[model samples]
Structure formats: structure tokens, C-alpha cells
Target: MGAFGRMRNSLSFTPPDLQEARLEPVRRRIVFYIPGYDPEARTRYRLLFVREWTRYTKRFGGGRREISRAELSQDGLVQSWTVSAPEQGDGAETRYDVLLWDDIVARDFARSRFLSVALLIVGTLQTILSGLLFRFYRLSWKYGNVILYPFVMVILLAALSVAIAALVHAHLGDWFGHSLGLPLWVSLPLGVIAGLVWIKAIEAFLNRVFFWQLLNDWVFNWQHGQGRRPDYERRLDAFAEHILSSVAARDEAGHSTDEVMIVGHSSGGLTAAEVAARVLARDTSIGTSGANLSLATLGSGLPLVAMQPAAARLRGEIARLVTDRRIVWCDFHAPQDWMNFPGFNPLHDLKLRLCGQPVANPLVRSARFRDLLCPETYRRVRFRPFRMHFQFLLANERPGAYDFFAMTLGPRRLREQVLAPDAYSEPEPAVPL
Candidate 1:
């Protein structure tokens, strides 16, 4: 049996029809994927994309001929990878060039014991205060849960600290008195050392729950001169310039660069939007002159940053993108993803109050994990909100509508796939009992 037939028989749900759109020769394509505040090596994301793409192609029927090794740019801020694949039918073979724009400033923040602890403490306090002042707790119960997570961690850590201190005092005190003939001073220092050790031991885990990177980036970037990270901003500018140059090069070579897509997940959403805005700022005619420019933001935590009063630059970027009708911005929101402000419109909610009329550039759409995953798998992960936040990148178990791999790797144009009148559907609210 063919791969498509086998995939069809093996799956419980129907996949989105990739053949719906007219098959065209895909000559050139560029996908710039900006990840959230993650310090892990870029190789991990490449592996993830390969795995998900392999699964998607196997299940949905396509062939990937080659995937290139990671090639780092001279500045070390950007990494590029390529994949060559054929369309489903007699369509053209496509080359997908993926660039990962990484600016993980939190890696340094996380390495230092004092810095990590300070940021976490400050981040926790800031989150609580922000929640109360902004009424984030009432805006969404998820924000309430986010606010409570740190306190819960604190309580757990406090209990653990006390227990450790008591254990050290009981056992080490006796050891010091009898064996070493030391005084009570030794016991106090020992207890203090033990507490510090405990905090260090759980630092990485604490980072995951509290999202220190996300919080720190938001707060730090809002500061004057973006916390002295001019390089970070410069890299973003370079990336935008590179994108425009690449598109122009492809066009000048007489190749049909069908689409240039900028995809960002979580905090990266804001970054992606900013990058697109920067491109527009550099070349006002980018969207109209060249290939189709598209932005796909998955589980965007844009509001978290844009809501801050200090985020004037980010707010301006968002405002520009929202007002520009040339760029197709598709914001994918999952109802179960608590990390992001799902179904929240940044321009409207942020109250940018533009002088001119607003254009509906971002067609906010709902990505339902429940429909994408099988019932058993869905139930297993329904309560795990963090995992669900990443479901946007994972391959669907039972496809209903949205397919991340298909949109990025398949033959269909992003506009043909997401710009349908019925494509952007409102998520159904729960029926009250």
C-alpha cells in the first residue's frame, strides 16, 4: 500500500486537504521560525522539526529528499537549516530554508546562583503585583493560576528548606559537638549552606514553572536602552534585512519565491511581529513588491509584553503590523494554552488608540487540541497546560483543521490555507450546566 493509504487507514481522523489549492511549482520558500525564551541549543529545535515533519509527511503523504546540517552565521546570532521536499502530486519540488533567530539573554541570568535567585524572587513579586494591578487574575483564570504557581513553589521550597535545616541541625549539630568538637556557629553555617544548596539544586525546575526567562525578558526589554542589549536589537534588524534580501535575490534570479513566512511561538510571537514590522519599516513596499509576506504566531504571549507601559517600541510594531493590510498575519490561539493570552487582540486590548482607522490584519483563529489529538491522548494531556502550549509544534494525532507541519512544509500557500472565510473560527465556550 502507498504511504497515503497506510496513513489514512492508521489514523482515526481526516487530515486537512492539501490538494484543495491548485498545485503550483514552488521554486523558493523561506521560513523564519523564532522560538520563545529557551536557552537550549538550536539543534534540539531542528531535531524536533525533522521529527514532526517526518511524521507529518509519512502520515499525510509527501517525500523529503534532503535536510541540511545546521549552518551558523558569522555573528553566531542566527542559524540556518534547509529541507528539500516534493509536493504531493505533480507539483514542483520545494526547498524550505528555515532560520532560527535566537536571543536568549536569560541563559546568562540563569547561570549565576545569585542572579537566578534574585530574578526568580523579583519575578515572583512582580508577577503578583502585576496580576493585582492589571486585574490579570480576573481577566483569565489561567493568569490566576500563573500567579499562584510561584507561591506554591515557594511554599514547597520553604517546607523543603525547613526540613533540610532541621535534619542538618539534628544530625550535623551532634556531629560537630561530638566528633569535630565545634560550636553552634558551625551548625548555623551548615544549615545556611544546606539551604543554599537546595535552592541551587531546584533552580532549573523552578525556572520552568515560574517562567523567569519570559518575565525577565519582558521587564528587562522594557527598561531604558533594552537593558544594554543593543546586539539583540541589531540582530533582529539584520535578520529582517536578510529576509528582504533573500526574497529579492530569489526574485531577481527569476525564481518564484511563493511565500516568505515568519512563524513565532509563545514570546517569539512578539519577536516575529516585530521582525515583520522592521522589514516593513526598512522597505515600505516589501509586501506589495515581492513574494507574499506572511506571519503565523502560535500561542502568542504578545500581550504579556505589550501590556507593559514601558513597551512603546513593541506596541508601535504591533500597531504598524495591525494597520498594514499588505501583510497577512494569522494569530493561532489555543484555548487550553494558559501561557498565552488566548483569543486576546493586542491592538484592541492594549488600547493603542491609533489616529487612523484600524485594519484587521491579524485574523485570529482557534487551534483546538482536542480535535487534533485522539480522545485518550487528549484526556491524558488536557490538564497539562504547558504541554498543550507546545502542541502547536507537535504532529496531530487526529487531524481536524490546523496542521502546523502542513502549513510550513506542505505544498499549499499559507494564504490559501488560512485565509479562507471560514478558516478563522471562534472557539466555542463551555455550556453552563
Candidate 2:
């Protein structure tokens, strides 16, 4: 009993110096921006930072917890790390630009992964509980035409769903254990039955609040002086409009842009591409004058919409815009990822079916392709095969991906050297993800 208790105590977060355990992978990569280290501006290079740390963890919480601290530091810097782990424990970590772009890339990536899991887990549970309470409701024959009340039920279900999510979230410390949320299949019918008011309430309070706050802050601060394709796309036209409107008053300042990039990941990738296309279509509204643009898409599922001819045509329009804008499109897709299905010729679309019977996931059936795009522009651009969708912004895994992103994705000044001198100067070499 004492031994077990003592083991639990040692797990608290603590700094590197005070650690009783061995120091983390003593090896460190000095991740900073190329021209110089600007913690705020370097969010795009965050991949390089994350690429360096995925394999390591160190004890951090000062008490008796074993939480690992992902650190950030540099020249004349103190021992500081930005822990992007959210209130709900998720695998995603966020990259922030503490001193350079790499930090931003790392922290944001972590955050994204964290949210993805939360969405799946929380969303599933919320859907299930809602399904049980509402879908399986025993409509009493007693209170016919009584006060119509979805509000009370919505709140009750929302509260219960949140409670369940919170409970499951608490147990994340126990990895390698069964997940605390509802098992698969339960979420679909359950979530569908949950109703809009309840779903939105849960989404707003639990996920949206956390996601939007952090992401919005990063966008407003890090996106200035960035170019098309070179920078990560995190905003919608309305977001861009706000920024443009704010800056419209300031001399419409001129800033030299070496490169411009727009990056999208998973669903975000789709949103990013749409935003970039709109911005490109209306560059005058968002430009800081004299800025170039490049387009980089990671884990793209442009093919998902191909199942519907109308949607396929819409994506084709976006594709054409990418090419027409003369912005190079490097579409990355991975086969192993369950996040996106249909792992082949992107042009061909597949309808989601159940046991060979057509079933509909409205969201997918909606904007994913045709739901959010223009058909004319979607047809023109080509999606080259990229197998590793999960590692879209990964810095070191695939040289082609790394090069396309780090070197070619941004404008002249904003870009970094992705490949080693040997790859650029040398002959053909086998590229792997």
C-alpha cells in the first residue's frame, strides 16, 4: 500500500532540475525562425518544433504527478515550456511562437490533435446521452398538448452530457484503458437524436469556447505580415474582414513578404482552403500591399465530396482557383488515417454507405465538398497523392512534404529551407513519409 501510494505521489509535474527521474532525451533541437527568432511570427514552422519532440516526455507538475512538460527555450532564455494540453485531456498539443515559428507550429499541432480526440469522445458521449434521454423518451399519454418544453430537456440533457464527458475526461490519465465515452455506433444515433439546442449548447460551452479563444488569439497576432499559402489559414472571411477593417485605417502599411502560404488540417484543411480561395479572389481587401501567395494543403479530403457530382464540381472550382491563382497546391493525404476515408484517386467520389446500403452523414453530404464550394473553381486543380494525412505539417518525415511546406509554401522572406542542401543539390533520392 505504501509503495503504491509513493508511486502515485512521484507522478506530479516538476521542472527539469528537481526531477528524480532521468532527464528527458538530453538532445534538444534549437527551433527558431531562420532570419531571426520571433516567437510571435514563427507559428508556421511549428511542425519542425513538434517533429523534434513527439518521442519525448518529462515530469512537470510540481506536486506528485507525472505529467510531462513540453518546453520552449532559446538564446539567453530561461527554462520555459508552453503546455498546450487542454482542460479535457486529448492527444493534440498546440504549437505557439514563444521565440520562433517552430514553437507556434508545435503547440498548435498539439492543440489540434487534442481537440480532434475530444470531438470524437465528447461528441460521441453527448450524442449518446441525448439519444437516450430524448430519442428513447417514453412519451406519456397523460400530458397531451401541455406546455411544449424542449428548453428544460435540452438543458438537462446538455448538463448530463457534459457531466459524462467531464467524467470520461477525468480518467484520461489511465492510458491503455477502455475509453470512458460511449462505444462506437452509439454516438451516431444518439447524437442524431440529441436535437439542435442541446448539441449547440454542449458544443458551445465545452469545445467551442476553448477552441475559438485560443485559435482566434493566434490568428489575430501571428497572421500579420504573412502571405498567401505560406501562412496557416485559421480564419473565415468575416475574420479576415475584421482584420482588414482594423488595419484599413493604418496607412495600409507596406510590408515585404518573402512568401505566403495557407495550410489546412483535417476538417480545418477544408475550411482553410475555402478561406484562402475567397481571400485570393478578393486579395485587395486583405492585402498589406506587395505580398505573394502560396497554397499548401495537408490531409486534404477533396475526394470525399467526389461521391456527389455537384459537390465534386464545387471542389474542382476551388482546385482551379488554386491553380489559376498560380498558387502551387501541394495536397497531402494519408491512407492509414481513419479521420478521412476513401484513400484513392481523389477525383473519384464515394458515397458513405452502411453494409452496402446508402446512409447519410448530413455534414459530409453537405458543405464538405459541394456544401461549401463553387463548382467552376473546383474542377481545375489537381490533387497529387500524399499518403500521410496525419503528418501534414510534420517537419522531418517526408522530404517532399517538408520541402513543399517549409521551402516552397511561403513567400520569399517568410519561407524556410525544408530539405537538406544534399536533397536540393544532389540527384534523385527515395522519399518516404
Candidate 3:
């Protein structure tokens, strides 16, 4: 029989004795450090033991595998493991055990609660940037006979971006649906043109839309303080300094250390990169001496930065500032993600080029966040290499999320054995353009 034929022969509605995949317990001992001096951050890290243990256990299966033990000291440890399950019907049960550790990842979770909440709110707001920038109609108004109206820049660009995004996403899938049965001339340029137009429209709105109060506050806080934060680069520059100084303090006395890794998700990516850049410029030690300052952007919404009311000088600084050549700037993108860059979202790539190119900073994209929630099966979806954009940052908390995190972000701090490459994916391996 042919390859397709053999697969159909072994079918039965009832459960069979096929070899079931064993659910193994995960173990690791590692030190997780975050840059800062916030008492709040330390508090939040402490709270993580309570939240992560509860969430992961429920998110996956029942609380059979997870085991948690507490410590008397202020700093505690959290250990987790998944127990085996019986194969029955079409589904199975898995247990997780989290054992308390002498240490924790990050810091006081509640202390940085403001930071996390701010980032989440920013994530929600950025979704509306493109939609809010355009005008449906600026036509002249007329009650009796006097009527006048002009298309403003924000409205025009916002509308264009939406229209372009709709058209490309709606049509390109069909055109490329076939195996290039026709020549590439027709569809490739069409896709690029459509994508470019949308990017330009979004960029225009961001560049001119006048900074919204909420955005400025978040940016300000990320740089220094939150919501009350104003639109100033100095605030962010200070923030960069704070994180760097904290990192320096944490470094062991004998070992010479230089850089701090800024790991950001979605909107956090944009804010971190820009703020870090400004910080580096203010102090040569942060940028010039060692390859210390690094950026790891996940599910980026950096284009949101353009939506602010930036000054000519600020724009000039962003447009021309150079990054240390050795700084590692890694980006994770997922093709299956609706909000992820380079798919339905084109703004991310543009922001990177406009900001990253100036400094010759190395830019790399990897595959991530592809598997979606499987509705039909009880088991969560599997991760596809090059596909998990949204969940890459959250992988630390998801099923098999460990393998991906360990390799990309884990090896440095998260100690887990044999992180599987197929568990998730990396992008086209950073090819220079």
C-alpha cells in the first residue's frame, strides 16, 4: 500500500494499546535575576509561588503532578514536576508538582504589579492604534448652506492602514493558496505593495497623532514612573540607568560585568528598546565598553511607539542612534499569531528597520507561538517550530513552554535538561540583508 493507505488501516473508535506518550516530571535549579532595586519587585517574586503553582496546574490538567513546599526565610524556592497519567478514552490526565525552592525567579511579583499591569494595558491599547487613527468621513457639514471639512493626517493614515491590512489579509491567502501555478510576478509584488501601504499608513498616524495621555504615562513609568509619566526621553533614560545600576550591584564582586538583558513582550518590546538606547547614550559604560546591553523582544508591538507625539530631536535621535555592535537583539515572531508582526501585522518590521538599522544593531527573528488552543482535544496544542509568537514570553508558564524558554532565555538562568528544539521554533536564523 501507498504511504497514505497504511495510516488508514489501523483505526478503531475504542481505545487501543498503542504506545502512549509518557508525561514526565520537569526539574531544574537556577538563579533568576532581574535588574532593579524595587522592594515591590521582590514582593511580586515572592507572590509568584502562589500564582504560578495554581495557574499552571489548572491550565494543564488537575493538580496531580505539581508539589510545592514552603520555606521560613524571605527568599524561597519553587519546584515543579508532572506525574504520569493513565490513558483512557480519547483523553488522559496529567499531574504537576511544584516544590518550594530556596530561591525564586524575578522578584517580588506584587512590587512590580504596576509594571505588569501597565504593560498589559498597553498591550490592549496598541490593538486600537491603527483602528483609531483614521476618519470615516471628513466631508463638509451642511445644516443650511455653509459646509467645510478637510481630511486630517491622522484620519487619512489610519483609514489607509486598516483598508490595506484588510485587503492583503483577505486576498493574499487565496492568491498564494495555489503552488505558484502561475508566475510569481502577479502575487509577490501585490503582497509587498499592500503590506507596505498599510505600514506607511500606520507609521504616518503614529508619527503625527499627538501622544495619547495613556501611552505617555506608560512610557513615562516604564522609564521612571507610570500613568503620571510625561512625554520625555529623560525619564526613560533614567529608567535605563536604574536597571543598569541594579544589575551592576548584583554582579559578583570579583567578576567584571557590563550588560543587562531587557526582555519585553508586545508593547514592552518597543518601550524597552527605545528606553535602553537612550540610557546607553547618556552613559558610555552602558553601551561602549562591553556587550552588556541586550534586547529580547517577543510578540513585538513596537510600531506603537511611532503613534506618540515625538519631537524633531527625539525622532532624530531614534533615527540615527547606533547600538553597540555586540548587543544581542533577538526578535521572536509567529506566523499563526493574528497580532504578531510580519503576518497580519506589518508595523513591527518597519519599526525595527527605522530604529535598528541606524546603529547597525544585529536583528534576528526566530519562530515561536504557533499552536493554538485545541478545542476538540483536552490536551493543549503542540508547538510548531517557527510558529509560537504570542506564547513565547509566556512559555515559561505553558505546557512544554519550558523547552523553548530554556534554550532561548533559559540557558542563562532557567536550568532544565534537554530543551527540545521541536517543542518550539526560531525564525530564519538571522540572515543579513
lDDT of 1: 0.65
Sort by TM-score, top down from the best: 1, 3, 2
lDDT of 2 by residue, 184-211 (tens): 4554344444443354566666433233
Root-mean-square deviation of every model: 9.4, 22.4, 21.4
lDDT of each: 0.65, 0.32, 0.36
TM per model?
0.79, 0.33, 0.39
Ranking of models by lDDT: 1, 3, 2
Find the candidate with the highest TM-score and give its number.
Answer: 1
- List the lowest-lDDT window of 10 residues for candidate 2: 139-148
Which residue segments of model 3 deviate by more than 4 Å? 1-235, 250-252, 255-259, 287-291, 307-323, 343-359, 362-366, 371-390, 396-404, 407-409, 412-433
- What's the number of clashes in each of the models? 0, 72, 47
Which consecutive 10 residues in model 3 have the weakest lDDT in total? Answer: 139-148
The CA-based lDDT of model 2 is what?
A: 0.32
Tens digits of per-residue lDDT for model 3 on 55-100? 4335543324323343332222222232232232111121111212
